[model samples]
Target: METVKLYVIVFDSTHSAIAAETMLKEENIANEVIPTPREITASCGLSIRFNIDSLDKVKNILKQGSVSVNGVYKLERRLNEKQVEKLM
Candidate 1:
C-alpha cells in the first residue's frame, strides 16, 4: 500500500465551494467535492480535496476566482486512522 498526502480546501459557504469546484474544473485542476471530514470542522459541509502537490496551483486559482476559503488542511489516512492538520 502507498500513503498519499491530500489537501482539503474548506470554504465558508456551500456556494463558494461549488463555485470553486466549477472554476477549478474549467482551469483543468483535478479535485473532488467531498463531505467535510469528521476530523475537521468548517462553516460549510463540503470541501474540495486535491493532492498536496497541487496546493500552490489551487491557491492561485482560488485567489484569481475570488473564492472565500475558510481554511486549508493536510489529511493523512492510514489503515483505520486518519489525521488532519490545518495548513492555512
Candidate 2:
C-alpha cells in the first residue's frame, strides 16, 4: 500500500463520528475510524481518518449529508514525530 498524508475529521460528538464512518463506507471512500489524536484536542474522542486523495469526496459527502464536524486536521509525521495541524 502506498502511504499518503492523512486528514482527520473531528466531531463534536461520537454519534457524528460514527455516522461519518458509515457515510464514507457507503460512498466507497477509503477511511477508518480512529481515536482522535492526543496531539489535537477535540470534543469527541473519536474521529474519521482518510487519505488525502479522498479529501474532496469526504468534504462533499459531509456537506451534502449535513454531518456536523468540529474541525478537519492534517495528520503528519516527520522524524518519527507526529505533527497535527488544523485545516481550514
Candidate 3:
C-alpha cells in the first residue's frame, strides 16, 4: 500500500472556510470542504482539503483575499494509520 499525503487548511470560522472555498473554486483551484480532523482543534468544524502540491498557490490566494487561517496541516494516511503534522 502507498501512503497518501494531503493538506488541510483550518480556518478560524465557518464563514471564512466557506468564503475561501468559493474563492478557490472561482479561481479553478481544486479543493473540498471537510470536517476538521480530530487531531486538529480549530474554531470551526469545517476545513479545506487540497492537494499538497497546491500548497503555495492556496496560501497565496488566501493571503491575497485576507482569509484568516488557523493553520495548515499535512496529513499522511497509510493503511489504517494516520499522522498529522502542522505545516504553517
lDDT of 2 by residue, 1-88 (tens): 3334668999999889988899999999998898888877856899888888888888888888877898889977665667777874
Please list all clashing residue pairs in model 3, or write none if there are none: none
Query: Cα miss at 50, model 1 (Å)?
Result: 1.1
| Candidate 2: clashing pairs of residues | none
TM-score (C-alpha, index-matched) for candidate 2: 0.85
TM-score of 3: 0.88
lDDT of each: 0.86, 0.84, 0.89
Query: Which lDDT tens digits does candidate 1 get at residues 1-88?
Result: 5666678999999999999999989988889999988788765889999877788988888777888999889988887778888877
Please name the candidate that would achieve the greatest lDDT relative to the true structure: 3
Give the range where candidate 1 is weakest over 10 consecutive residues by summed lDDT: 1-10
| Tens-digit lDDT string for candidate 3 (1-88) | 9998879999999889999999999988899999998878765989999987788988888888978889889989999999999888
Comparing 2 and 3 on TM-score, the stronger one: 3
Report the Cα lDDT for residue 34, model 2: 87
Task: For each of the candidates, give the backbone clash count.
Answer: 0, 0, 0
lDDT of 1 at 87: 79
